[model samples]
Target chain A: MRYVLFLYAAIAFVVLAAGSIILPDWAMFLFAMALAKGLVCLGIVAMMRGGVVSFGQGLYYCIGAYTATLAANMWGLSDIFLLTLLSSAVCLIVGVIFGPMLATYRGIFFAMLTLALSMVLYGTLSKMSVLGGSDGLNIAPPTFLGWAPEGRDLQTALYIYVVAIVVIAGTLMRIYFDSEQGLITLATRDNELRVEYLGASVRKVMAYNYIFAAVLGGLGGTIAVLALGHVDPEFAFWTTSGEFVFVAILAGYMSVPAVFVAAIILEVVRSFSNLYFPNTWQLSLGIFLLIVIVTLPNGLGSLLSRRKGGKT
Target chain B: MSAGVLEVRDVQKTFGAVTAAKDISVSVPKGAIYSLIGSNGAGKTTFVNMVTGYIKPDSGEINFGSRNIAGLAPRLITRLGIHRSFQIAQLCNELTVEENMLLAGAIHHDERPSFFRHAHSAAARERAMATLERFHIAEHRNRLIPELSGGVKKLLDIAMAMAGETQVMLLDEPTSGVAADEKFPIMDLVIEALRAEGVTVIFVEHDMDIVTRYSERVLAFYDGQIIADDTPDEVLLDEKVQRYVTGGPA
Candidate 1:
């Protein structure tokens, strides 16, 4: 495990060095967004693996973003890092508390229940005048400690991005999938009765996964809000949650890196299409999603596994 | 590991106005293969659900091993060494077989929610593989649950339960829809694997031959009550049990 970490750090150091010299701001932005999106999707992957399809991740993401916003503005906090941690703590608490209810449901109902919760959050947030009501609040330039964050907040964003990508996508999740509880989550999904008799509590497993998803969503949302310098009730809206699910499908559920790659590609496509076609880009996006769904049953991650198996 | 004893005392359950289970009490000791046989709507599933902590009984108390586990969280019961497999295998058809094992593995992996703690250590993977190998389908480790045959999927489903490495297991009709020829081998494998590990199993089934073959004792549920609870041969010979099972003793 330590060796994997060391290797990861070495590779990241090399990439950051390369990015600093070669990539432009736009490319860096894409990378950062992709990484954040991937982490968020990974949480969804965790949830989905347990036979759940949550449409409420947007609520966690928005909570993460606004909690940081609330921390920075209400408390005059200077450390962006601390705010990130603060947001994560909040999401974890909420996830652990409400996750069981979500886990109790299954199939389309599960999806709808998550969407309903997120919408409830959105409705509540939109009504709060203190949260800038409908217009949303301007996010202040977040500084790390006392150091006036260097070179176009993008660099700061990029740094946070790299950290999120490495930690969120690393061997922890890989090893988790190998662990006893991880296997139970799948068992719980496949056969709750079997899991129960085996002396595993499916509820606990599902709750933990849901909480993990919340933490990831919160982390990603907080960073994205800080990057965009604004957050609105829309952060909790179903559409945002829907977007995460859509991204998960595009990347397929299992591939952690594919999710990041897909996120960047989605953003790039949206940006380029908007620039070129203006109005019909959504159509293009829909078509692309359809293609992936039809072509890849397991999504992009299956390809990597299939290749690895073939080589072996 | 704490004696693997399960005690349910005077447990009564009502769904709104309908009585699902009534004054039911049974105790399963460690290292016992207990079989529950009943007709449809006999409350076998309901009884198991209550014990698993999915639903609270209107009355009575349940002691799992030494702990009073009545109406506790299902996951908590699981942590205390109780696991189950549904009648038709309820796996997430979308995930790979290995990934399926993982969802359960993560929680049992540690007490903390550390995503950074790589669960894919040599120890975890080897354990998961060993679990699959125990079920005799380790070769199909990479296949998706939906792609496997009903028998194979059933085996994998049981493998997921084994993933938690629990001592007590609950199965609902472990051989429900398989070819008749496959039933004996499946039960044989399940019984052998679980017994070799010293795991106790309690299952519900309509197959009398299976009960006679694998169970040390037979529990008969009729109208939500255990009308007959005894050694398989004893239960088979009892007049009332004969009436309940075949309308009259042959």
Candidate 2:
């Protein structure tokens, strides 16, 4: 465990330094966007343990971004660090209220409920002019304690994502997923009847996991919103939730770090395909997902583990 | 506190027009290896489920030790010292044997079963390992549940339940449908382990040798209520229990 932490810390340091010095504006933005998406996928994997595919992640994600957006626009709460804290709190609170109803259902019913919730948010936000409606609202360049991160355009975003990555979110969640509560999540997925018999509460475990996922999702949403310097209701659509699920599936539901790799591959592939054949990027993505699902039943990390264990 | 580990009053449970368990009353004393024997659908499991708090009784009062825990959630009841193993092997098929045992211990140590305030620390691991050793499955700890044989799966399920800080254990057919050769070993291990913990064992089984061998007393169920509840010898020798078993009491 100590060795893995050391290795991850070393890697984070290298990436952080490189982003500030050698990386171009586009690369930095891509890196930050990938990291933000990676955090959202972390929440998805947390839910995935229960065999629940929540399509309402975008609803919570949008709530986080919009909370920050509203804070800045209507309330003039302009400090980025404080806004980040407030955004995460709001998302978690909303998840707390919605969790019991949303988590009580599983399989397709769960999926549809989340989708409906996200769509409702999208509809309501699109009609609200205070949120700037479809045109969206722009955020001013954020000051962290009045000292803006010394980076241009996308570089600043990459720095923010790097902060999110190192903020103990991943480490804390790693411990969580290894706990007995984590086992309850998996047990509930496997057999709710047996887990109950084994002295577990399926509803409580599901609710806790849902709320944790919302916190992570909101954190991701806050980072993403801050990165783009804008917020809009469309960001919280069911389609966006679909995209996060897609990333999680492609990454597999085991390790949190793998999500970043999956996110980067997604961005690189989508952009490359769009540049060459803009009309067929969606088709290419579909084919890629199908291939990954078929060839790697455990996801790409399985391949990495196989190689490491010398079992391939 | 009551001398009985579990004191069940006249419990009633119904499924619409169908009465699953009716006026079922039984008191399990401390340190008794009690077995419930009955044909399928005889309310053996329903009684177990109700006592364990999986299903709420329509009307009943259950006293575990001193506290009335009729409608408490399974986790809360478990903490108050009741554990259970299911008929259909409750081990997580995806995780390893050791992982499953550790998870069982983790509920008491880390996380509130609330999944918050995780107590997943080094101290928890030591206790989890000790529970694994008690079941003699420590050697096969790394193997996943699906890969294990039926007997090993049964062992894992028992170990998982034993991991909880329980004073009473309700095992629903601990050796049900396993190979005849493997049945005794599994039962002996589970009963012995739970006994070591000073936990009262109440299990439902159809096998008569098992009932007579490990159980000090037996509770016979007929049609949704306990008809003959006494020692294995007493219940087996009773005319009413014999009639029900010989297909005359229907």
For residue A104, give model 2's deviation from the true position in Å: 1.7
lDDT of 1 by residue, B1-250 (tens): 3343888899999988788899998878888999998788888999878877788998998987678888887767777777777788877564566665554455556564344444555765676777777787778777776678888888877777766657678888999987899999999999998898888899988888899999998898888899999988888888877877746552
TM-score, candidate number 1: 0.76
Question: What are the C-alpha RMSDs, in order, of all predicted structures?
Answer: 5.0, 3.2
User: Which residue pairs in candidate 2 collide?
Assistant: B110-B119
Q: In candidate 2, which residue ranges exceed 4 Å CA deviation?
A: A148-154, A157-167, A305-312, B110-125, B246-250
Q: Relative to the unseen true structure, what is the C-alpha lDDT of residue B163 in candidate 1, on a scale of 0 to 100?
A: 62
Q: Encode model 2's per-residue lDDT on B1-250: one tens digit a residue.
A: 2377788998999998878898988778888789998888889999988888889999989998779899888777877778888888877777667667766776655345534333344666677678777777778877777777877878778777777677888888888758999999888888887788778989989888888899988888888888888888888887878877534422
lDDT of 2 by residue, A1-312 (tens): 546755775676566656656767777777777777778778888888777878778987788788888888778886777887998999889889988877788899988888898899899989988778877788766667666654583366446445555436776776676666777787677777667766667887788878988988888888788778888887888778888988988887676667778888898898899999899999999999999999876666666542223111
Q: Give the DockQ-based CAPRI class for model 1.
A: acceptable
Local distance difference test, candidate 2:
0.78
Q: What is the interface RMSD of each candidate, in Å?
A: 6.0, 4.6
Query: What are the chain A TM-scores for all the models, listed individually?
Result: 0.91, 0.91
Error of 2 at B173 (Å): 1.2
